[model samples]
Target: MTTDPQILVQAICTLACYSYLIKENFAYRIAEYTLVALYTSYQITRLFHSFIKPYWQNYAIGEKQYYFILMGALGLLLYTRYAPPQYRWLARYPIALSVGWGLGGAIARSPRPVFTQLMDVMRPLNTANNVLFFVFFMAVMSYFFFTTGKESKFIQGSGRLGRYIMMIGFGTAFGNTVQGRISLFLNRLSFLLTDWLGISI
Candidate 1:
């Protein structure tokens, strides 16, 4: 049997990765360790370049001395994971600030796209599509009602219809998830075959 060099290299790498399925051995361990080391090195380099250097240059040397102090405080707060229970409260300040800023940013932008845009799409009072949409909306809302007090027959029927709607939504979500996993697998395979093994597609 004849074998091309590139194809042979690709086959070897694929086998090395898949070997873990049979048993844990040297090849799988080497591949796993290499990936972890590479990822760690990449993250360290990125953190230095993205956060440390820029802040040191722009804030440490520039007029933004407050930012430098804030950064130092935040860094110190992160180390509080090793500190005692009473000192742990210091970490909450930065965490709360981060969450509050994030929430404020999201709230500022949410009304236009999520609320106003949806409201703008509402049709006039006399269209069939609008009537059907209102029915669907009411049905979906009925399904979420936890206080099962005196519900009308229509509301109960609407809740049943909502269950079918949710089933279709869930099926679509599952199918999309499967497709995403397959795509990620194919991406890794392409990297191993083409880049690492120098095999043409």
Candidate 2:
């Protein structure tokens, strides 16, 4: 048993939300709204501390750089969402800047994965795992080979093997996801039964 009032309150909120599973009423609605409000408040506080405050302190007040001022002005322009129509064109500039910057970053990072996969496949086949990996990799990759096509027996067989491997991989992934959900449900039940109700198994 624990003596923390915060944990007790949290457990109560959890039970309140879970009450909907039995039947929906005021308690569940209150609990749902309370969670949304708390989350919004927490996010606002986090962003203020992590980003807004730091940016203001370093760029807005201390350094007073032209870049920061431009950036800050552009960011503020996003609030033009509520402004009249003539000034709405100002909003597009910031949207374009953010989208262009994000796309440039994604383009810069695109080659790393391809290069890594290439390097992995080119590793020496000194061990059993390496040999098997190379074989399976080639088998899977046969699905993408366009020149010879699947007219050849070898290509068809390899593609079939690759399909089976992919199916097995997908099934395993689905099973793991179900297991994870069950684990979460059990954990919540444990919190309700043991922590709140003080019932030991």
Candidate 3:
């Protein structure tokens, strides 16, 4: 077994986390809460070093850009949600500002990506794959023909093909997600065996 203190601690934490797979117990709860607390502290430290310290040193005080202080105050107002019920309304301004800013940014940024996707889908049908994709795309799009009558046989056929293509796409995506999770699990297992136990696999 590895005697390094850091490695030992990590091994213990890993075992504590894995214990949850068997049944929820004190060790699992401790591991869960410890991870959360550590992550929260780490994020706060990073925020201070990355944003708060730099903002204060460069913009707020150094450059005499005192308007930055208002931005800081606006961010702080988000915490007022935890205040007394009457004072909680103070959080609404920041919340609304954040939502509006995010919405506007998203609207501004969406067009380029949508246009790019449309361009990609309009690729030349020179290759077999491109031709197949074009057909699939049209069939899938036809599935959304809400105004088309059920008596339209062509539309019905295309819509049914679209549904099957969608099902296959969904299944493939789900399989990839499961494979990724399993990969993570295998990596952790390898770490336990090779790093903690000092086993040559």
Candidate 4:
């Protein structure tokens, strides 16, 4: 069976992206830039259609004129970065507002997942897997605490335990990395053999 035109185009783009593994050349760079440009254009279109146009046309023009004014002020403030050195400090107004709003939003949403979950994990009395999890947690935490003199027997013992725990983590991570690389290699090999050379997998 023949592939669709859209599938053929996608396959060509994928091959171009995979070409980077062989060497950095025009094909890879072109594909990379093309993908980025397409994504950026799509995002700009989405922002205008979904946010700016709808909000301005429906809400801001009617009962929310104040929002339009605020948006204009914020937009002008963002442009202050292009001003002369003497006026460049004006950019801080928009920057500060953006950061403050972002921080508030993040903090409002963070506590339940971050603090509550941490507290729940630390509360060994209420935990179902308390023994195993607490031992693992303490072993990992001990790896970073060096206040106890390294020369002391107790400190040396804890340090050895921590070292083993860390080694195990590192070993697992390394194994995962190798597996991922092998998978990537296999994918490229499949593309080269099956697509370009027309060999059946």
Candidate 5:
């Protein structure tokens, strides 16, 4: 096997991680702590490069955007949560502002995709799949209707069908997730046995 320094370190770390599969021990704990440290360092570096530096460059040098200063003050209000009890109420201001801003942004961007989906649902039922989709959409909408319980036969049937459709969708998603994880595990095993150990198979 070619003893490349980077590959050797990576293989050691991978082996340390896989040791957890046998039983969690010192090697696994060391690997976990190493990964956490690396992740935290990467996150701090990203925050500096992506957000803090950009905002600083914009507000401090080029654009001189005064509202950015206000934004900073609003963000600082979060620290009031640790202040004296009387001043802790100031924390709610930032929370309220962020929540309201997020809500409005979500509402603003939601209509277009919703309309696209509505158009898709209301499109021509030329094929069997289209017909099934139409029935499923209507049934699911019926399931969400809060006014009527399953008292009426029509509502009962639609709601039950909707529940079954939802289960099918969930089951399909879960199955794909399991298949993907299995593939990942097999790929890692191949890396260990073939790449690191240089075993011909």
Candidate 6:
């Protein structure tokens, strides 16, 4: 019953998307394509305003940091992907540069996460939960000792416990993911019922 244009359009799009659950049709396709097109255009506009414009004005032109122009040109080379067959190879230089830079950055930053987890695991065993965590951590670490001989019963028992702990951790993660998705579904359903239909619920 809402008269607001934005809310009405949102409700219509939501229904169009949910219609696919019943059966795919032109309405669902229209909604899906519209969402993709809108999202793409929004991202392009945001990139231009947030990054390209500022970089050009501040670095390339104003501050005489002309190297930014070369960077921009390199980025432009990525579009050579759509060029004719013979000319498409020009895109690989930019692609290769990007890959190398990304890999180097990732490698440099990767140790931070490992160190963070290690620090967390090295917490004081002052509480029951902390003690439990330390024991579970050791068990899991023992399970990965591929070089160690499995003749000892202690290692076998620890590894078996580690496997069950891992299963529980995985199940918890999966349940959290499902809960997040259901939360989104509930929000959309609430919008349809309360905002669109003007219901009190």
TM-score per prediction, in order, is 0.69, 0.79, 0.91, 0.74, 0.84, 0.87
Scored by lDDT, the top model is: 3
Q: Cα lDDT of model 6 overall?
A: 0.93
Candidate 5 Cα lDDT to native? 0.89
Error of 5 at 119 (Å): 1.6
Q: Which is better, 3 or 6, measured by TM-score? A: 3
The CA lDDT of each predicted structure is: 0.78, 0.86, 0.94, 0.78, 0.89, 0.93
List the candidate numbers ranked by TM-score, top first. 3, 6, 5, 2, 4, 1
- 20-50 in candidate 4: lDDT tens per residue? 8899989899999998999999999999999
Any runs in candidate 5 off by more than 4 Å, and if so which?
none
Model 2 bad stretches (over 4 Å): 1-4, 23-26, 144-154
Off by over 4 Å in 3: 149-151
Residue 3 local lDDT, model 3: 94
Indicate the residue-level lDDT of 101 in model 4.
93
Best by TM-score: 3
Task: Select the stronger candidate by lDDT from 1 and 3.
Answer: 3
Name every residue pair that clashes in candidate 2: none
120-182 in candidate 6: lDDT tens per residue?
A: 998898999999999999998888877663787888889888988998999999999999999
Cα deviation in Å at residue 176, candidate 2?
2.4
* TM-score, model 5 to reference: 0.84
Model 6: per-residue Cα lDDT at residue 168: 91
Q: In model 6, state the lDDT of residue 83.
A: 93
Instruction: Report the C-alpha lDDT of model 3 over 7-110, residue by residue, as the tens digit.
Output: 99988998999999999999999999998999999999999999999999999999999999998898898999889999899898988989999999999997
The predicted structure with the larger TM-score, 3 or 5, is: 3
